[model samples]
Target: MRLSTLVYMHKNMEKMEPLLYDVIVVGGGISGLSAAARLKQFHVKSLVIEAASIMGGRMRTHQETNLELGAQWIHGGVNANSLYNYAIQKGVLNKENKIQEDSEKGIFFYTSTGRMIDLETSQKAWEIHERIVDESENYPKGGNGVQISLKSYYEKQAKEKLKELRQVAKNKTFSGEYESDLDYDEEDLKLAMDALIIQFEAYCGDTLDEAGVAVYGTSQELPGGDVPFPSGTSSVIRELEKEIDERVMNTKVTRIEWKDDSYFISTEERPEAYRAKHVILTVPLGVLQKKSITIEPPLGVAKETAIANLRPGRISKVFLHFNEPFWIPGEGDIIFLWTKKEMEQGVKSKDWTTRVSSIHELESCPNWMVMWVSGDAAVIVDSIDDEQVLKGATRILRRFTGDPGISVPDKILRHPWLADPLTLGTWSYPSIHSKHQDYYELMRAMPSPENPRLLLAGEHVHPQYWSFMHGARLSGLEQADKIIKYMGKMKPKQNGISAAK
Candidate 1:
């Protein structure tokens, strides 16, 4: 009766049920849901089996509001117009909001020594980030097209910039003692500056040095490109689920065994098995990495390696509700902490682990402060208690505002994607030192076998759009098209029913 008991029962799915569906989808996240919904467009019969109770795998909508647990924003803009705009057109997104494009506001610079600096220095860092991407465009050897880690590459470039900084200070006609301090070798200063930039890793979930350049290099770029959230991101999925729930099997799938002609899906909640002609695996990279579900004949080596090696972006979201807005009177952009040590060691100690205690100033939330925890900072925070996380974040806010006695947050909402069993980590990120080719290879879509029985569709599988919600949507539609083509190849069986339906 219980989920655990059913899991260990070791039932054979093939013996429980005969063919019952045209297609059975494993993992009812965005990809699975989207694929199943698209099947409806073609008047195909399908069922979705989810490990979790509800659908929308990572795109979880808060019960009370428009907030999303996993994906919060439409990262790639006009590029996302097809996917995002469709969501709006279909009433999945109520209204689209656009903010000013200039980085002039809500951008601040900090030194490794903990001194706040002007925006000019920050702009230089942004420029360097661009250079890192540009530099990665060329590669030495042919390999899997993956995003190489940018940390080392960026650190090298950052050193050059830091050297230039010192040079400028020394050349000042009225140079003071501070100029003398800037005379240190670029290597020494670069190391310090590298620590400051590690704070940005908090947004990506890995130290810059460990982050792959390949993953970040292919990002869509545009001047004043708009960033949009689903007014409430959670609602989009809720809207999507409304059309698919009638057929979704809202439970955990332990094993799927396919014999010559049909595939069998077994769930713990029910002893009955569901058989289908085809199965669409919409599981996220995180879930695949966890080995949560077993597939007969196993997924191929390429897909398995991708499932294991493609590091899920280590991201966590912390929402702090305040009684009243206190810090950054009118700022709307999120403030970042530029520090020397990486996130793991930056704001953590024995008293707080997985505590992203510093880096405040959210331009998005007028009165509320949200912490976008990534990389080591996210890992550190996941290790601690909620109370500690709350205290640590508050302390950072207080310090940033130059107000040591900042009031405690009214409510603290944290999503531990790393710790969650269903979601082992956040979306995909580049593996350590891996190249862009490797990532692209992972993104390359593959149809099932010589006949195309099984299909792979998800954000991770979408080369250019991987990691974004738009990527997930595109993969879904693409898989649907492939399925349609595959179905066309088969002639109607001489029997009573269609081969698939």
Candidate 2:
């Protein structure tokens, strides 16, 4: 609906039933649902309001494509992962559709010139990957010897590696074991750098020039490996839906007027407000940063400042389904990169196809290959139409595979989370300048002059699992626990009675 229509409803809608509750959880995403489920565990009265007709938030899957359009992976399958454990315990994971580990799959790396990097060179490429991860934790010191952009640090090191290769006339270990002759030009550096940046896009949602060099693996990976869901993440949503008795769908929370331990929740659909003694906001950090929902008696400076200071990630995916797979078979996933010339020509041609992060062959489904898009190219993706996206994608695929007879994909699917009204972006990431204190500020809600009337929860603010589904889920449990302890300090407000002084 248009903004004007929302404003009109805000001005003229009749007072619907004044839905009063002990607690109201805004957002039906995992965070909110988890909070509501935990609250139910304590036998605390609670209701959930979801803006979308369905729940699961970013965990949605495309029905036709069967592609997980959001929250596509479980980084940690068991132990340390509550959500995955829940899926296992409840048998929510589809047994017919087994999860596949992305790392264990085969991967092929191709240059812009349509030449696949040999296995030996691919091993070197992995060595580069490890070097960059190390850089994420600790960047190489310049003359001044401090941290710099991955781009700058990487280029400098690449230049040095080239000099050493030329000096020795062959690729060799520093200990003097000969490996192979370095047969590369300046273009190889560009290709590797660009591909690495694209890979970071999937994780950090920022360009290499801007991403904090050492922030990549700074957060703990849940061990094991990430697995894609063939049945989609909706199973988790369906499970949460069963637990939530009061599910308010399609209610866009516009303004929340909080005062004296009570919340008057307003929505675009109704001028009438839902009153609650406490409110839990499980909205994504992007939505909160957008200030999509106004909180009357505005949040405290710390909360506002934290919201402004923290960074929200942006990413999108392109899924191309075909009659057959002409791509090479790897044990795991495939990494495709454009040659410097190919990358340049595509940009000059205004085709963003060269921007794909990775072309992942779905092991469970052979007819499809998913391409991840991120960084500046992702921004450009929003402006182009679908036909061009498919055309550009196929053109690049044929060029890399050297298969002129390869036909166009039978269908195309793209996930533009950046343009999503509800999400506004993907997960959150700590930029080069981010601090933990800001996250703390975002987590702790403003005291209502009398009681803690509001709480915030999402993957971004998670202590251990930031930017992951498990982190978001655990955050809700933590927030619910916080509220439970908070409410323990005072008696529950009886219905139709004001708890305010």
Candidate 3:
């Protein structure tokens, strides 16, 4: 009976559909969907093919409480403003939908010895770090464009600045200014670097080496910005999906064939030809890194070089939901743990004793803190089994709270962005050794003389805002405009041919 049932199912499989579209979008992420929505506004019929079942690509929200997994806060919302705001202007984000920005009050400071320190001292240390960065970068409060790669210049400048600062620490010079300066030795600087390594890894779920250092640019290259979140980034995605007349979710595009001035896209879920006059490739840099999709005749040398050279980063978020807040008490809450060992070795009991919170309110809520693992730390965390990662995080929290009796959280939310087949990484990070701008031209490449339909857009292409959400949104808008312009030029010709016929 089982054999007969299998035979009947195989024999009755549905036939494939050969659907052609005005434009074929290869990804369903923020950029792709945003572009598709704009295309619809231009009265262009579009098709979006996504490998995942849900939309909003990396701008993910959890199912249980709708907490954001991919992009939580509206970083730079007031300044850059989230793209979701534009969607809201067009009736996307509703009245009830809002973004929350709270202040952090419960401040704790810890040391390498696992001893809690005075909050005033930690603030002083951070202030010193900020001042040094400001001096080294020649930071302008007016926000003028000071183009320099901060990482490269700051590290180089650290030698001289640290030397001078050390003298000030010994001599007690510049009382008001030098008081906050951390009297860090060479070893202390290394410790700070290790801490930063963990911080960046948690931010982008990438490795330190894989992280990019923007060189030849001013301090503004990686200038500090506000945290921004879309009013309803996910809702905007759903709305945009509606714009595409035809969309195939859970369909992984594996190959692209170009001939006769047209593009053919094929997917594993459906064995058929999906043709398009033009193709907009919005896949993340990581997807292309995996070589998941085969391009017939291959992308040109320049484009291929850029695609192959600039690799994507692996990033993910691990969210732990506790029953109540235990350690901190107010808005804008943050806890910084000063430890000697790497984050992956697991948060030691001693390390947590030094945990300090900037937000007092955090103590009132569930004893929960979201530790962002990025760079090398991200690689380590993501590579481990889920249970092990959770246990490690729990141990860290218990140690920080000095609560050995603390129990595991009620819920654990984690996004396997690196494990995701479609999105191989969380976001793009500029490599420390390579010049990312060199590959910028490839990202901007359009199909040549014979076929001018192929185009590329993503966060990596945005030199200034490469790893940022704003960069992705901006790239989508730019590409959409280019495609629209290209189509406008073809419209008259099409009309003329019709009249002749």
Candidate 4:
């Protein structure tokens, strides 16, 4: 049956019978939408309840500038990634989309003292940083019996590599290998080490000290590299929204009560309660951590423990739109390297600008530059006003580029994901106290897997793909399939028909 027809029938049936549905998904993000779409394929009566007025939770895009305000990249372009495949099939991604290569070809690295690092030295530093990152992954796969923070591991590797480089330079000088002094100084070496750490922190969406080394390489990456939607990431959400738009309701689910085989979902605005045989929760990890929704007959000790251990990571972006570009065109990215002394001073001053990872020119929108911030700085930026953020970003850009007369941005765009009640934070990260098993625990269905009443689906619950869009999409599909199989078993035996089919 067509989904529109099914939706119409369900609406009419609601008047006579109780408003019971086969499944009611809470949180209308990618995970919830995907689940609802999959259920619609099987002609299952399902409804999606979203707290926000609009769909596409974190995948928000600015209509005026066509710039993504949240969740921009389609990490892991093509390979076996379902999200990428779906975007490609839906014609949302095109040649305009750029592949994010690991090479630092067009990037310029500048020190806080207004000195740009030479291309050769910068390239060499990047190569060493990448090698160290790859090596750190071994810790999680039993390379070391004792797990440590990524910060500690990175420091150890950086020290060793720096010592080795110094020794090599000494050998070359002693042998009279024709060279004009040392290619880099001690200050330059320090900048490379510290800058790489900040870059990794931005990728993980938190400070390295808070992230566990044991979970470093647990998440798998697709082969084709990351890609961003030129039009916007929300295009993918819109595609999925088409399949289940009628089944979606804009309302906040405040409390959920499960008794026997039925579940009651209460909303903040509506007085009437919605009944369902099963509930699929796809809310963000931040929402769950905050306990924004009450789950009656509380989620057991294990699930509660998982929620407490896994932390919500903070990541925010500051977009500055310029009338004319001050820096050279085609310079892919501008990385700011802070001196140890400057970093120490900033801590005392509460300078949030020190936390910015890099400033990159948008490929699709050349006039716009994006400043990446994470960890404590992201939280600080989220709390501050836009004028303060603009001033801070301008100060950093002028200082790094040695251009004191750079004009202020005509417009600025930013989203306070950390402060936003709906999101609370950006994504999930494995804290020092978190374990790999916690993800599986989060995925476990309530009561029992054989006869499930409450199931969880979100990016945080994916064992190997946590914090990725594809992971969330896959988790939704997995839970939907579980419900279909369970319904198939529960079907009456009078006819040789299966609900799953």
Candidate 5:
């Protein structure tokens, strides 16, 4: 059915007795849309209620430049990722969609004082960082029954490695075999540690002190590297939207009340309430944490505790569209390294520039560059004005590149995901207080799992794939299957008619 026809049907139904849908999927994001689409495939009556004016929640694209404001890359590329495979099957993504890997682009490292580090030294530092990260995968279990943060583990390893490197350099000097020009120094050690923290924050979606070390390598990754859609990430959403014909846009569900073996979903925009035999809530974890929507007969203590334990990850991007490229063509990423003194002063000064981790050239958009700010930095950047953000970005670029004459961007684009009420934040991450079982608890159906009337579906619920688009899509399909099976077990009424009908 066409959207217009669905809208017409909804309007006409609202004027009369409320129709009890078989399933009502809340939040028209990837997860909700996927669930509704799966339900439609089984010929089940379903409706998607979205608070936003358009679909594709976090997979939003900037209409003007055709650039993705959220979820720009498909993390697993074309490997075993279900979302990537689905997009390929729908013909939305093809061979041309593959993005240039980091190795393909020239990467340069620079200190805060505008001194560029040699490639050899930078490579060595990165190698050391990678080695330590790899070792985290084998972090000893049951360490005296005391939990440790990723930060603590990283610091301990880094200190030992730095000591080893310094000892080797000292031995070489004593043997009269040391080359002053090629030797690693204290400055290099500090830069490596700084870079590691910045990169880890981006990966973990929080400061090292917050994420637990136990879940360091719990999430699985696909074989292929990250890839971006040539058009935009929303291309997948467009395809999914085609499969889902019934959706009410701009309908913000304010409350969900369970009564008489059914769910009465209330919206702030309309007087009539929506009735459904089952509901699939796909809102972000952040929204649930904020209590934006009320649930009568509140979720049990176990589920509520799980919700409180999982933290919302945040990340903000600033797209600077320049009239011309300032640096060398195809420069993949320019990483900024802060000295120990600069790091100390930056903490006291609370400078936004200090929060900038790296700037990268967009392969799809040649003239555009993107600056990544994650963790607490994302919150600050999202709250500030565009002009202030641009000023700070300009200063950082000039200082890092040692180019005093670099031109400011002609246009700057950013989306405040952290500040957006609908999202509240970007994704979900395992915090120091989080446990693996918390994910299962969060997704467990209300009342009882045997009779699941209210189902939860989102990335946060996925055990092995949380914090990815594919994870969200898979969770949606899983919930839809649960609803389908539940409906299958229902017998017809005495009149040989279904209660759902």
Candidate 6:
């Protein structure tokens, strides 16, 4: 029978043959897969139901360039990440080809006027950034201070400490930090403001004005810097696939009805409901906020409130392929620190991506130029007409490079995570109204009266590590351990025969 037909047909589940599973994991993304992978170690039977035919969710690789459309890097040092450890143990990653960026690559910088800023100017920027981050770390609750955006806080602080910041940049020597300095000058404040705002827009997936001061740098950075995989993030996805026992692809779940200590999961692909002892609900926060999956009796107040309160980061990436390198050559660092002229024009277009954050000329692929955009700008690029997008992209590229001879890219690739209904956004971020404990509230779920059985695990739920892939991975393993421990306390059925087997 076709999936659509099965979805509409309401048959008597009692008459149908029961498809039972020990643990049924929904949404076979990194979180769900990691949960199942850990279950394998316990010799626990598991089934993964994925809506998409392909297993990897946000970790998609672009076909033409082989660049990651979603997660591009391991975001970890040599051996600290367990996900990387899994890939290495499974012979997925090539150790010799690992990539990391540093000042050794000779970082490049440019201004709205296409003029390069002195290293001192960029250093001042980093110092200002440190001040903002320090403030965020110190103030976990935004309500403690007069409620305001990170942008406002930055402006107020930058104005007060402008002279001190200038002196620090000129006098203090940062050994090898490549962060573009926050320039403070009557002549150069535009350069600094544009740079600062773009970083917030790209990183937070919202205007700097909307992002909360408390959650500015709340997401914990792992020990090691980012580890970009030339081979793509799929290698790690493939390595983890071996651990799954059974999986159903193209199965879109509509509802999860729990009654009498068992779950009845309905999907678009199957007529009969799938029975499971416990479920690992690992869908993205956006999906939950939309109520994509209808829970029988509804979740707790804390969890439900969190689903409504937290904001999902809607971001996009645009890859432009050129015939050749058009910018200045031999500059090892692929970064271009230039903001567009329209930004200084004192007009804010609905098209927020007027200033592209970083234009990268990757070492592995020199012919391709990559750019990252977040928030409304990314949405503008995705939703606008192709001609408009081309015109905007061309203007930004030409203005920054100071090369009017630069022609349009031969091909363009876009990572439209927001457009994807399943994902809905790039990641989760704390909005201005958020409480620090909101993530923990979302993480806590109950299978029954006071038991932590129907657990929630995802990067969005991890307070310290919410936006990172490593956080999602760690949350999955954590949930799996909870289930394992829960199961150990209960004896096996008298028959010792699962309904599926």
Predicted model with the maximum lDDT: 4
Candidate 5, residues 104-198, lDDT tens digits: the string is 45557888778878776777777777887877756643232245788888878888888788878788778887558544556765676766677
Please say which candidate is ahead in lDDT: 2 or 6. Answer: 2
What order do candidates take by lDDT, descending? 4, 5, 2, 6, 1, 3
lDDT of each: 0.61, 0.70, 0.58, 0.80, 0.80, 0.69
Give the Å shift of residue 342 in candidate 5.
3.1
Among residues 3 or more apart in sequence or in different chains, the pairs in candidate 5 whose N, CA or C atoms overlap within 3 Å are none
Judged by TM-score relative to the true structure, which candidate is superior, 1 or 2? 2
Q: What digit string (tens of lDDT, one per residue) describes model 3 on residues 1-501? A: 254663354234446445668888888887788777777777777887878888778887655455567765445443234453565455754434454433243345433344554555444444445554456434432124333444444455545555665676767755555544553343444344334333433443354444343431321332223433333356556666666555667678888888766787878854445878888888888888778888886777767666665657765466666676544444324444544454444444323212222212222224445556554445566667767766766666566556666676667677777777777777765444445454456446466533447777776666655666667766676676677777773234464462110
TM-score of candidate 6 against the unseen true structure? 0.83
* Order of candidate numbers by TM-score, starting with the best: 5, 4, 2, 6, 1, 3
Model 5 poorest ten-residue lDDT run: 137-146
Task: Record all residue pairs in model 6 with backbone atoms less than 3 Å apart, i.e. clashing.
Answer: 122-181, 125-181, 125-182
For each candidate, give its TM-score against the true structure.
0.80, 0.83, 0.77, 0.91, 0.91, 0.83
Q: Residue 87 error for model 2, in Å?
A: 1.4
| lDDT tens digits, residue span 8-106, model 2 | 643454655556777889999988998888887666788888888889998988876667878887777765678877776667664343345444554
Model 2 segments beyond 4 Å from truth? 1-13, 94-106, 138-190, 214-218, 328-334, 339-351, 448-450, 489-501
Candidate number achieving the greatest TM-score relative to the actual structure: 5
Model 2 compared with the native: what TM-score? 0.83
Q: Write the per-residue lDDT of candidate 6 for residues 180-232, one digit (tens) a residue.
A: 44333434543564466566566666656666777645676666566766567
Model 4, position 141: C-alpha lDDT score: 44
